[model samples]
Target: MNVSLILIILLIGALATYMVGDKFASKIALLFGLVSLGASILLLNHYNLGENIGLFTQWIAKPNISFALQADGLALAMLLLTTALTPIIIFSSFGTEVKNAKTFYALILFMAFAMAGTFLAADGLLYYIFWELALLPIYFIALVWGNGDAEERKKAVVKFFIYTLAGSLFMLIGFVYLYQKAGSLLIEDLYQLNLNGTEQIWLFAAFFLAYAIKIPIIPFHTWQASVYQKAPTVGTMLLSGIMLKMGLYSVIRWQLPIVPFAAKAHVTIMLVLGIAGVVYGSIVALKQKDLKKLLAYSSLAHVGLIAAGAYTLTTDGMSGAVLQMIAHGFVVVGLFFAAEIIFRRYDTRTIADMGGIRSQAPKFTSLFLILVLASVALPGTFNFVGEFTVLYSLSQVNMGFAIVGGTTIILGAYYMLKMFQSVMLGETNAKPFADVTANEGIVLVVIISVLFFFGLYPKPIVELIAPSIEEIVNQINRIK
Candidate 1:
């Protein structure tokens, strides 16, 4: 079947799952997710380098926008990540008991649609619509089903909503200004528009705020820890695994080329902030007792390095940032899922409360250990491939920045291994616990296989994304 037809069927399946009620909704969602994954793979296989496919058109008059979708290497990579994770997220939810399973499954499918739209959209307004649309379902999912105290959940959700929305408003202003200047909402048109240095600076700041809040660089990251701590395991998985990359992707797609001069001029300060965030997040995570909170801080550190790499504008840096985005998405989800399994068994998330779990759950301990190693960027894991590329790229820009960024590996290992030792080792003193269940084992095994497979053979992904990075770099060079 054609791409458009496949998308339509998936959308229908999403709605149908919502209508089908609780009993079979999850199964239907899983079925549609698999179909979407298949379609994404087919699109990737058929992807032609230097070719653009115009999927559809909308808004003929007044700005000349189109419902256009293309399968460039960058878009395809993100599509693969999204599709691959959807079913895993769905399956992970098997351990969760939601009030209305149908609504829950529907939300997951709808999130998939929104994410696909964000990657595929070729128009600025359309992309922004999908971007904002993606936030609502997740907000509800977290607020309704999140763990922790009731008030804390509410506060976390509200803080996340407000922070993201505030940033989004700036993005909206930036896009509107682009539309006014370029007389079109097409992303390509914006790239060609010539703006003065002043305009570029202002527009860049506006766009930066939006993406930073989402990637959540240092100061803007206050909301993320609590939100991650409060969110249900599946919710946390989706937020960390797939959603955060939306911001990183936007920085590459929208901000850089459109305002290359501004980005280049202020890249030093941005790099400083990135380095600070990396160090600060790692140190803070080292002290976190809650597993989710620790993971949240670790995510902050990872994205800070990614933001630093994006600003470097070097080919290796950009490509590494992209690869890291995909790698972190998978690795973070696996870690969070492992945390969820522990939480489910012991009914607690505090490290001090968990002890001797490895004695009772050997498979769980083994899987968690592998995931921890991946998180710390051990060799033969995808995280190692991504971090090596990113750090090497950063070193090309500044040895100091690379040195600071490298500290994350040390701090990451300190915290992760400490957590593992606390939870997975020591004398048996806790209530009875089961080993990793079949579903959990499957989820983790898939993640591990992908992690090692990509780690050992990352050339395919590098080849796929390099062309787009080259295109973007060429655009920035034109401005220079």
Candidate 2:
């Protein structure tokens, strides 16, 4: 089957889950989630064997857009991340009380479908459609199912919607301009256009505006922590675990390659912005009193570094960004899940309301500790591999950049460990804290296993994505 099967499966899953009703919605959703993951694996195998799994065909001939999906090591790696985390995200919801399970599960599957399409679509307009489509389900997920005051949650969700949609309009404008000049919205065609410095800079800014907001770098990040605090844990997981990667993936896939001149010239500016977010996010995270909000800022910090690595325009930088994207995807999901676990028992997201759970639940405490350590990029965890490489890439650009970016590690450790101590340790609360249930244990174990396995042996992943990273670097170098 072609790569489209993965998308088709998720689409069908959404419909089927909705039709099957609430009683069976979660089950069907999980089943479909697993099946989609299997399809992605099969497609990956076919791709490895050099079989063509991509689809390119006419969709709208008038505007020169086509229904195109490209499958390469890089795209498949992202597809795998989307598919793999979906089931875990779905299963993670089983512990919580979900009103209107059918709608909730269906939206999750549909979001997966859109995200998977975003990664695979090669035609520029088609890619934009998928990119925009991914935002809808999350908006509703956070708005309707999200916690907190109704008016406040509505405000946060609406702001997030407007911010992302507004940013995407600029991107849509860029694509239109590219299509006008190149006579096609296909990525390869856009890459071939002989744009001068001015055109390249403008287009890059347009696309960067969209990506920067979605990646929520610095000033544009005002919406993130509130939404993360308001959204349901499952919604938060989907956003942190998979959706943010869409922006990072687009930087590697569309932005840098299409406007190498601007990317090259502004590398320092981008690096500075990214490093600034790293510092700002880390310090803010240290001061957060709410657990989810702390994790949200931490996400901002990690993604800022990833963005910096991508802008470095070196193979090592791009590769590290990809690795970190995958590593962050899993780790953030696990960390959010841990927060949800605590909330499930204590009914609070405030750090002050939590303490000494370690006394009651050793298993939960140990798992949470490992995730915290992983977040800090301990030497043996998968995060270290990605973070170290990113720092190395920054050092290649400028020693000062590396030194500044490296603060994420030290600051990340201090804040995360501090959060852990406050939430998971200290005097035992009078409230009894039970260890994780079988389902919860399974989720944590599965996540930890992947982190440790990849930490020790990342060769397969590194090799899978190496050629693609090399191609991107080659594209950047072609500017000369």
Candidate 3:
């Protein structure tokens, strides 16, 4: 099957949209995104039946690097997530007053291409290329089309770019070493390399450094809140909803698989750090008065739990991490869109200023409540399936880890309820709080429906990803 065709479609659409100009760029981008999603679904169905979707060519013969792209279970799942979200992101942007709409919409498609390329690249150098490619479009999007004071936005975007790029340098170094040791940049070759403990240790640190910054775990998270606050809703959505997953996905795909010894040896400490982000992020969220920043911290906590799950090195944990990524991706997009909807009407993000929105706009309130519930992993929601599985995995490892990690549940509920009560449940405001518009309603409906569908019947995703999770688990277990 044609794995890279989606990338071609998205990239070509980006260029064409630029040519068509702003008046129609949004519609064209959305159309391309929908087509890409349809193709990915077909590939996913083909993939589930145990067929390969691979593209290979010699790119650098001397160093044994290839322009290889493969969509195994893990890659397909991530690719599907990227394609599925792109249309919604574009559709969600339908009402925004983004200057140079053609450029803005085109960049979104380019970013999607880079993300898909990152997911499908089966060669180390190629993967790194795609990974780095993703950072540029989002940077410009946030910088050029962002909200707030010009000086402040520039500072935040600059910090974000510098921090993430610095991390990428380390990942590149890690890849270089692996290439030298294995004599090939192919993922398969690196996976099969028999490195000693010392080499694995350094390589693990190198790769993890990049992922950590992108994941923005604990201290590295400095760039996150400000960037989210400063960015336009579209920028915030792309960063939180999809870009962050790149780091988590790389952890599962590259770090643990190629350097299992280091992963296992350091698993406990790494897992501890991850759990710390969960507790830390939630506690911070509880203190935020700004709705967007509050949601940012909430995102941090959810992803921390997901990261902890990945580091558990168990089938359940890995599977849960994958599922949670998809769940969280959709939920966060809806949440941010809600935030934007609120700001559009009221022109303020301060929690203190938001009240009686529910009384004014019942439908919007209901959808938001559902997203809030899903965010906290309420029972009968898709989040619960993944969160429960992850906690079970940690508890199997040590009840203590589960105990610590589970704080997000309590902390999450506390802050989300607080946000809802403050923003939606008060006396009706004198200011207007209109219901969700048709465009906005469509996006939210799709998000909620998918969450519920997967919540009730998650077996298809679990089954599709089971083999990849099993393969990853076996790799980690084989470490010695």
Ranking by lDDT: 2, 3, 1
Candidate 1 wrongly placed segments (more than 4 Å): 1-9, 48-51
lDDT of 3 by residue, 1-480 (tens): 688889999999899889999799899999999999998998987887778789999998887889999888888888888999999999998877777999999999999999999999999999999999999999999999998999999999999999999999999999888888888888888888888999989999998889999987876899999999999999899999899999999999999998899999998988888999999999999999999999999999999999999999899999999999999999999999999999999999999998998778999999999999999999878898889999999998889999999998999999999999999988766689999999999999999998999999999889878888898888877876
Q: State the displacement of the C-alpha of residue 180, model 1, in Å, after optimal TM-score superposition.
A: 1.2
Each model's C-alpha lDDT?
0.87, 0.94, 0.92
Which is better, 2 or 3, measured by TM-score?
A: 2
Error of 1 at 217 (Å): 0.9
Q: How much is the lDDT of residue 421 in candidate 3? A: 97
* Best-fitting candidate, scored by lDDT: 2
> Which ten-residue region of model 3 has the weakest summed lDDT?
44-53
What lDDT does model 2 reach? 0.94
Please report how far candidate 1 places residue 471 from its true position, in Å.
Answer: 0.3
In TM-score terms, which candidate is top? Answer: 2
Instruction: Provide TM-scores for the models.
Output: 0.98, 0.99, 0.99
lDDT of 1 by residue, 1-480 (tens): 244644565677789999999999999999999988988877777775334545756766766677766667888898789889999999888876778889888888888888888888888888899899889989989999888799989998999998999999998999888888988878888889889999999999999999888888878888889999998888888888999889889888889999999988998988888888889999999899887898999989988988888888888888989999999999999999998998888888888888898878888888889999999999999989888998999899999999999998998899889988988888775589899889989999999999999999998999999888999999988876
